[model samples]
Target: MASMARNPLPGTIRKDGRRAFYVYLSPPLIRELKKAALDEERPAYELVEEAVEALLKSRRIARPATDGVA
Candidate 1:
């Protein structure tokens, strides 16, 4: 059996100094991220990164609740 391979992107930096990969998003999400960055006077990349981190944290916290919800 073959497994999927991991390819790292050029500009991603992992917290532990390891490799990080980039995933493409839909155009609509890109537009929304641009709008958010403009409104908050922050870079679009920073805003997107913050959003992704928050989502990951939320998922980790919600996993236990989901497991009990059978």
Candidate 2:
């Protein structure tokens, strides 16, 4: 039988320069994220990114400006 392991490399970068990485969360956390995404009518990834940006800000790490016109 074939192994069920995922690819060892990070997934491809998108045209917008985003790459896919793995994140593991508990089942309850997953449900909460889905619920918040539905309630806010936004993608779950947006919420996750917002949370991560806040975390980085708390650590005093600066994120690059994402305003258009790159």
Candidate 3:
């Protein structure tokens, strides 16, 4: 019998201490996002991250480089 690999426990901190959360989007938006992700051959999360960073910059909010620590 082969041993199976173990999955990370819920809420476990991985790279950059990223946490998973849910967001609600309209069906049309979801479709568009999925299509775009497929067309670009990139993960949806990367697109979301870019959009979020742009929004923060536009709002004059500073993004900390290391988990909000100076």
> Best-fitting candidate, measured by lDDT?
2
Query: Candidate 3, after superposition: displacement of residue 53 in Å?
Result: 0.6
Residue pairs with backbone atoms closer than 3 Å in model 1 (clashes)? none
Worst 10 residues of 3 by lDDT: 1-10
lDDT per model, in order? 0.72, 0.77, 0.75
**Predicted candidate 2 versus true structure: per-residue lDDT over 1-70, tens digit per residue:** 1332343344556677666757899999999999999999999988998999888776654545467422
The CA lDDT at 44 in model 3 is: 92
Candidate numbers, best TM-score first, in rank order:
2, 3, 1
After superposition, candidate 3 runs with Cα above 4 Å error: 1-16, 61-70
Error of 1 at 13 (Å): 6.1
lDDT by residue (1-70, candidate 3, tens digit) is 1232245456555577765656999999989998999999998988888899888776655645566643
TM-score of each: 0.52, 0.66, 0.63
Q: What's the candidate order when arranged by decreasing lDDT?
A: 2, 3, 1
| Model 1 misplacement above 4 A | 1-20, 64-70
Give lDDT tens digits, candidate 1, residues 39-67: 99998867767877999888877775556
